[model samples]
Target: MDLKNLFNVNGKVVLVTGGSRGIGEMIATGFVSGGAKVYITSRSADACDKVAKELNARGPGQCVPIPADLQSVDEIKRLVAEISKQDSHLDVLVNNAGANWNGSFHDYPDEAFDKVISLNLKRIFTLSQACLPLLSAKASNANPSSVINIGSIDGIRVPPQDTYAYSASKAGLHHLTRHMAGKLGGDGILVNAIAPGAFQSKMMKATLDAFGDIIKSKIPVRRIGSPEDIAGTCIYLASRAGQYTNGAVITVDGGAAVSANL
Candidate 1:
């Protein structure tokens, strides 16, 4: 393959949770557009099925939709089981399914905090464990599998919002990525986290809309992250170019982390 082809994700099997929309959809689109066979999942069956069809038309690649509620370990296991029925091995697993909640620190409910942690942090552990067999089936020195977690910049710095649980969970996930990378490296599986700043997605639409100019002013790039920014980062992580990269937390904020701290 040529040097430029090192970045290609073609012929790989990728699974992206919460792939119906937002950052998850962007990642799936990039992989599929590059010719990787992708499997997308979400709580909404209609949304999953819809994106699958749309992505299939994008390139030589194909997409499969697996509608699943990843709120618990059982559901995560089921999602993996469903995947096993289609392919023997998975080249990439993107833990992108998550939720955010906000409340006054003094009044944050226990269940609300638990809910964010459970979904954002706990389920990733379960899903990764469940996908181990598939990940290892064809893993090797030349072609290792990858576990890419979708983290947020909120984890790195305190945000203006009162989303205590969301921040804590993402911070935990970043550390967990390093921990998993160390443990899974021997198995030829890389682990990494992407800490994205403001982005143009439904999740950040309201925030950007309300504070578009302000957010731009804070970011050195004077703009929000695009689908390419997030997708390209992940493509590098899952492709041959990233085979030696492991246990890294890549911050795709365009210098927002620096400006925001100032």
Candidate 2:
């Protein structure tokens, strides 16, 4: 295989959940640019359709949007069935749809904790289970099917902020990625995760506003994350370029996790 083709995703079929905006949108764009036919999903059909149209206008790659709530298992089942009909073999699955809520531990409601875990942890497992058959059917070492879970920096190191439930859920997800990787490696389905730091998304902007330049100055890279930071890592994992990488949590943080507070 040509060196260039190692990073290429031509003719591959990928599915990305919560791919309408933020990090998810960047990943979708990267796959499309790499020549993969991608299908993206979110709870909002209108948002998904709009992004799909925008991405399709960019290049030769095609993108389809299917609206489904990742928080619901039934919705995932139906969504997977529809996708199976579109492609008998799926090349990649990006489980990026997740939610987090910040609250004081003493007053955190049970509903809030459950909500974060349900979508972040439980839904990820469900989606993987649903997509396994398709991934296995298309498995190959050179371009093996992949599962990329979007985790958080909070999971790896202690959270600077106090999103108790969010931190716990992501910590669990980090472990889950390793567990899944071991169980699925023999099946030719590579499983991995990307734990990102502060990014300029709707979710992180709020934190940025509160912390300002102090947040950026504290990081080793001295800047926040960009779409490319996420998109590049995600595409590499999904393509043949990352064939040997599995069961790893690639941290895309700007060295925030390693910096000593003292």
Candidate 3:
């Protein structure tokens, strides 16, 4: 009945991987802006500290930065342990760290493929597993913890660019969201994915630069995704409004993928 507080996330503790840039940064900002205590991580210590400092300065909330390369299990454990040192429980976790490679079908390097899969897919599971304690510690039947996976529309439809590893990894991530939801629901940990469309990200800069107008023309919304668009979607997922929304792949692509099917 209290609709005003339906999406309230004040005082919540959130962790966002690759939170120094792109969608991760956006999600972190959304939480911090809503008075949540947010922790952001990245491979670059400088990047992590910089974003955290800036958000902290602009806050009714607080931001912490934990910089650790997420390529190996050891590093993932270190990151989670560090979080445990600071907080007893986590209200939200956004697995947004990712990488991509563009190459011809014949000339794609094996290392590039492995690199994309390692960060985008393998590391997510590792980090999420490591955070199980923090995630489930304060989770409950009425108010559950949330895990938001940042996937892509490329996984649902063939992208115009040559990012085989990125697309395939996202598709796998979408399914993994469902798998984890089934496994974690009883513990009151909700798992879901947000498959984003084109946004102003370093990864999308070249594509948007080359095809920004054309890309917008094809979509039903006729525009690329804004930071607010992604930020709002994530906030909803972490808020009370989305407690029942598990195992769902919500596309925040301005209807690009759906129109593609039509």
Candidate 4:
């Protein structure tokens, strides 16, 4: 095993949920570029198909989009079953599907909290559990398979305003990452998280457009995140290079999280 090749994911199979756009799409693209056979899932079949077609056309690595809504536990099981039918084992799972609704705490209805927690926290747990067997089967001689949970900087710190449910849900997810990693470590299945700061997705773009300069000015890096930044972290965590790392939350926030309060 060459040290540099440890980061190579060639011939591995990766399943990324919510991979039609935003951070998920970027991660799928990165895996495809790195030579992994990638399977992406989303609620919209058309969106998944479109992205899959685009990725498969770009490289030798295959990208198949399997339409499944993470909110549905049965759908997640079915998706995993379908994946198992096609491939005997799975090498990586990136649970990145999530959404948020912004409103003042008093105005934030119960529905908001329910929806955020359902998608962000509950869905991740269900899907990962469904895929555990396959992940264990893929763990091997030299390299161990991995689970990379997508998190956010807001989960680690207060963001100055509302998004309370979303923030709290992600914070729970961060703790879940640690717990799962510990329990799964003995199986050679590594679990970790990537906490990303401002990225150029529809969600962040709206925030940037609304407060672009003010937000950028406050950051130590004087900029928001990019798709490549998140992709790079995912590749590492999923690849053999990161086999020794478990229960770690790698923050890709461009120094924002470390900025001094003073």
TM-score per candidate: 0.97, 0.96, 0.98, 0.96
How many clashes (backbone atoms < 3 Å, residues ≥3 apart in a chain or on different chains) does model 4 have?
A: 0
How far does residue 144 in candidate 3 sit from its true spot (Å)?
0.3
After TM-score superposition, the amount by which residue 184's alpha carbon in candidate 4 deviates from its true location, in angstroms, is 0.2
lDDT of each: 0.92, 0.89, 0.93, 0.89
Better of 1 and 4 by TM-score: 1
For model 2, give the RMSD to the true fold.
Answer: 1.3
Each candidate: how many clashes?
Answer: 0, 0, 0, 0
Off by over 4 Å in 3: none
CA RMSD per model (angstroms): 1.1, 1.3, 0.9, 1.4
Which lDDT tens digits does candidate 4 get at residues 178-231?
999999888888999998888888678788899988878878889887777888
Q: Which TM-score value belongs to model 4?
A: 0.96
Report the lDDT tens digits of candidate 1 across residue range 1-262.
5698889898999999999999999999999988999999999999999999999987788999999999967788888888999899999999999998878989999999999999899999889999999999999878899999999999999889999999999999999999999999889899999999988887788888899999899999888889999999999999889999999999999999878868
**Candidate 4: stretches off by over 4 Å:** none
